[model samples]
Target: MGSGIPVWSDLTISDGLKYISGSYKIAMVYSGDSAPMLVLENKHSYSWDICISASEVSSGVAFYSYDDIAQAFSNYGVS
Candidate 1:
């Protein structure tokens, strides 16, 4: 909760990596978009939160995997 990035907030980590909360770091495959809690790059920084621009953003991790993220978005009518 003292990570400065707060918690349960949707953020864009980078381009291919995303952050999740559950007393641990979970990744590999998700179920939907879910708007990553602490979006970031695992190769760059896991504990620290980094900021980036929309056009500058590269490949990071999404809270979901493939259909998972897609599903979550669809469910929320995110299109």
Candidate 2:
């Protein structure tokens, strides 16, 4: 697998925000006062011949809100 940043398509950011928001809300239903942590992953490489899954790297941030997700994306240059 190659090691580098993944470039997101134009709609990815907006769509990702919606996904995170929805996920958080769903988790809130069961979380009580605890926060739901989202793991941010980026796929850096993939090959059909590898006979395995794509390569991904975690952002190492425990995102708990839309602002945290947005800031992490910006910090990692995901756009």
Instruction: Specify the poorest-scoring 10-residue window by lDDT in model 2.
Output: 46-55
The lDDT of each candidate is 0.36, 0.36
Candidate 2 per-residue C-alpha lDDT over 2-76 given as tens digits, one digit per residue, 9 for 90 to 100:
123333322123344455552452111112333323344543442111111112223432224455555556666
Cα-lDDT of candidate 1: 0.36
Candidate 1 regions with alpha-carbon error over 4 angstroms: 1-11, 14-63
For model 1, state the Cα shift of residue 44 in Å.
25
lDDT (tens digit, per residue) of candidate 1 on 20-75: 22333333222343333423334544544332222211244333234444444455
How close is every model to the real structure, measured as TM-score? 0.25, 0.33
User: lDDT value for candidate 2?
Assistant: 0.36
Q: lDDT score, residue 66, model 1?
A: 40
- Report the lDDT of model 1 for residue 73: 44
Q: Candidate 1: worst 10 consecutive residues by lDDT?
A: 49-58
Deviating ranges (above 4 Å) for candidate 2 = 1-18, 21-37, 44-63
